[model samples]
Target: MNLTVDIGNTRTKIAVFNGEQFVCEEKFEEAAPQHLLDMVALYSPDKLAYCSVGSGQPAFETALQKLSCPVLHVTGETPAPVTVHYRTPHTLGADRLAAVVGAITLQPETDLLVIDAGTCITYDLVDAAGNYLGGNISPGVEMRLEALHTRTARLPRTEADGETPDLGYDTETAIRAGVVRGIGYELQGCIRHWQKRYPTLRIFLTGGNRYAFSNAVRQNILTDSHLVARGLNHLLEMLP
Candidate 1:
């Protein structure tokens, strides 16, 4: 068995895989050492792959070292199946790269647009030849809402939940609808923009906010919440 850990901006995700078969997954507000240790004990995975877009907690690092298995920390330079075309590969986020690898793994030899909507929304493009062409990053749903409230005096802090009608009826609904619906529009526009260039493009949506905007995207798109974890496992398998 293999274990993959993804520490995101606001949450941490861990998954267990039996070869290429996904067994289970868990999420936490933050990566707690004991939680991970318990998972390690329960799964008894032979290999572990980890990547983080969040702060590298020292305790978590210590816990990882205590594990008796090989641990692969995925960095920008980690060897993977895709050929990276980004000018500054070192600056690319591991989660974004992992998402692309997961996309290609699921759908090979095809132009892909991997959209990961977590704390930030990322759109990574990969050609049919497996060249990662870089991507764009934008504020996520919560960030957008927080920005609206913090950056301005009158705008009230709003949560993502609520009826997202075509137009908001009240202040809370308005903020929720505007932020959520705006994201929907942004995603739709991006898909259209990419489609013109890559007609055979296949869209893969992942991350927490994926389902929130899935219905908004008119085109056919594949949604996998565990994309980054799957990709991390794939990279572990590729290790020489």
Candidate 2:
């Protein structure tokens, strides 16, 4: 068994992988490292790996020190099997790197497009030949609303859940429709453009906002919100 942890920009995901299959998974808004340690003991995995893109590493490190298992924390500098070709490899987010690793692991020798719709929507590209080509980031649903409210004068702050309006009638509904549909269209456009360049592109969507898109008409999208953690486990298997 292996414990896989992904400390994302917004949330922390912990997974217990029993040979490439997750037995159980847990989520946290802010990672309580002690809870992670307890979880590790509960799972009793001999190996642990984590993807840290935030400041939760200290607690993770502290927990690892006391654990009997070996914890491998992945970073841009950390040794990975895949070669990263981002212009500034060091500046690349761990989540992006992990996503790429996850994409390639899904199927090798395939052109991959990863769309992570969390606080900010990120679109990353990897060639069938295996080079990581960079991506685009745009404000997501919540960010779009927050930016409008915080930056502008009158837009009200809104949350996404409990009966999302399919059509915009008034202010809040209009904002919701615009943000949601705008992202849907934007993601589709980007995928279309990228697909034209690489005829067969595998599209995978991850991150929190995946639920916003689970249904409601997407042409060729494969979603697994737990992709990052799954990818971390995949990377661990390739390790020496």
* C-alpha local distance difference test of each model: 0.91, 0.79
Error of model 1, residue 104, in angstroms: 0.9
Q: How many residue-pair clashes does candidate 2 contain?
A: 0
TM-score for each of the candidates: 0.97, 0.91
Give the per-residue lDDT digits (tens) of candidate 2, residues 1-240. 998888777888888888777678898888787778778768889788887777556766677667787778787666554667777777788788788788777777888898888978888888888778888878878778888789888888866643446688888878778778777778777878988998888888888888687564276778887778877888788777
Best lDDT among the predictions, by candidate number: 1
lDDT of candidate 1 over 50-74, digit per residue (tens) = 9988876889878887789999999
Model 1 gets an lDDT of 0.91
Distance (Å) between predicted and true CA of 99, model 2?
1.3
Q: How does model 1 score by TM-score?
A: 0.97
Query: Which whole-number lDDT from 0 to 100 does residue 160 have in model 1?
Result: 95
